[model samples]
Target: MELRHLRYFTVVAETGGFGRAARMLHVAQSAISEQIRDLERELGVSLFNRENRRVRLTHEGEQFLEDARTVLDAANRAVTNMQRSQRGELGKLTVGFFVGGMGPFFSSIIREFRRVYPGIQVSLVEMAPGMQYQALQAGSIDVSFTRALPAIHASQLRSEPLRNEPFYAVLLRTHPLARKKTISIRELSEETFVLNDRRYSPAVFDKVITLCTEAGFSPKIGATGSVSSGVIALVEAGEGVAILPQGSRILSSSDIVWIPLSDKDAVIDMVLAWSPKLEQPALRSFLELVRRRRKQVGI
Candidate 1:
């Protein structure tokens, strides 16, 4: 039988009369009586015993009532869950972040998002800038916290500058310039540089080379690491010094020192990038939260 038939039958049983059930349901009494009769004929069982002015449930009616209530409850819950998902209040969001930085800012945004939408599950993946871009294009990740590279121009992708900060020189604690508050880019002319692979972050690699060249000498490249953490590890091992975004300072070890760069133009932009085609309600909710938190923190 149809859900309306079951509903009418339940209401009739509850009110103990078709007249009252019709009044409660805002329907004609004859309509309610006809629906109940149709339900009984379909089920081949009488659901109610009608007296002069009252009604009572038969044995089969009691058993079917509980099952019908269970079905209706489940159906209601399903509808509610679907609506919540559509509203961006429930689901999973996969976010990508660069391996070296994004610790503080990313963590803060995620914490605030979790507070606001606890029903949405957030998962983090550590990827290089290039990999993050690829993941976004391939639908593997919802959004990414990465650097803006000149070579990474995509019509379907959008990038918003989240934070811009100057680069810092990461040096071994035993290095002579480690004690300095600030070091000029020219001072590193004689020092070997630990660089990140260009494929991993082309913008950072090109910026470092440009800065060194502008300082009147080519950077003596000692070694290249695939990621920022690896570059820091090399610096800690005294392989060479490296210049990284200010946020990279959080990844510093006790054996390494972070000194500000003297060059004013030596800066990098930390960006939030995503594909417009993949914008789901959950991702939109997250983007809105990011904007709100960024404004609150004056980022």
Candidate 2:
């Protein structure tokens, strides 16, 4: 039907109720209901099942939600594109990230880029590593700061390696292992290890596991966290020790100490990833700033 119908459907599906969706859309409750009814009738399918004062999407509705949201989002972006055309810059850039990627360089690059291109709006979204790849393919993200290496179809996209950061073992200040000037993967056999959630450090997890396996002992992975800050905080609380990539030293807690791995001095290459199909001038400038910041920081 009309674009308004798609908007109403998305609002309803997201809020899961006509009354609340109406409040969010600032439309009359009856109007919201009328639009959804029109949408369902036009599609010859029921989108929602109403039961016991709760609402949920049917199987057909669940499958169609993504298509509807895409149509609505594309329409909105078209409007922004027209305005950006007048300003000669991209309207918006959505960049995805995980914690260990680019660390300080990521923020510095964005700050400098926005300073020069105030008209272009940039949004940062933090998602899991696998989700970052999925988001990029889904057109939900334009660029990503990720530890995923180029071998994983990363070469198919437009990307540049920003820096390589060595991994370090972070231990609690009170732990006996903390007294050591340096540690190795084999030495961490009995240590409780905090793992980073797979989205932020997929490569790290794989590498750590592989290294531990090669050393004749599997690391005792204990607590887990989605962000580097959370892992560091857990280490400070004595829950477990964690392996951190280089540049994360900047986020060190006062009660924790970082020691390099003697035998496992492996590192990850921080990279900036984007689709070559995405040719926004502001996005291009943003990537340039990342390179400039790397040079400035002597990375």
TM-score of each: 0.89, 0.62
Ten consecutive residues with minimal summed lDDT in candidate 2?
A: 147-156
Q: Which pairs clash inside model 2? A: 128-199, 129-199
lDDT of 2 by residue, 30-145 (tens): 98988898889989999999874768999999988999988988999899878775554656888898655656667777788788778788899987666676677677998898
Tens-digit lDDT string for candidate 1 (190-280): 9999998988888799999999988899998999989888899999888999999877776778999899999978998888989998889
After the best TM-score superposition of candidate 1, give how far the Cα of residue 7 lies from its true spot, in angstroms.
2.3
Backbone N/Cα/C clashes per model? 0, 2
Lowest lDDT 10-mer window, candidate 1? 148-157
Alpha-carbon runs more than 4 Å astray in model 1? none
Would you list the clashing residue pairs of candidate 1? none
**What's every prediction's RMSD, in angstroms?**
2.3, 17.1
C-alpha lDDT (0 to 100) for residue 129 of candidate 1: 88
For each candidate, the alpha-carbon lDDT, in order, equals: 0.87, 0.79
